[model samples]
Target: MTEDDETALSRPQRRLLRRIYNGRTEPIVVEGLAFLTYKEASRYLLTLTEEAREAAYQEMKRQAG
Candidate 1:
């Protein structure tokens, strides 16, 4: 698949992409949430409600800045 053609990817393919692109060998902890892998963190983000997702993004921004 092309780099821009994410819509065509299956869930497993997406997870694999996240694992490769995230560049983290260990689990990621963000806002006290612990993920088994970057792929898991990405999957968790997808499950959040819109408000919660925005809140998490804002928190990440705050920490980064």
Candidate 2:
């Protein structure tokens, strides 16, 4: 961020921005609310590898049997 942008941000805002820039993949609590970084949200995507899906399917079928 530019000097002007930094100057405009509160201390907590700057801290949160720094954490995001440094690739922190956890929720941050502000006031009483929790916020997830973009990196953390992306980690929750439902995509799975083919091998992983096949293994899970086999496990489920085995359990059903």
Highest lDDT, which number?
1
Best by TM-score: 1
lDDT of 2 by residue, 24-43 (tens): 44555432334355333222
Q: TM-score for all predictions?
A: 0.42, 0.29
Clashes of each: 0, 0
TM-score of candidate 1 versus the correct structure, residues matched by position: 0.42
lDDT of 1 at 29: 54
lDDT of 2: 0.39
Model 2 segments beyond 4 Å from truth? 1-46
lDDT of 1: 0.52
Model 1 lDDT tens row, 1-65 = 23444333346745554544365445445678855554454565566776775565455434433
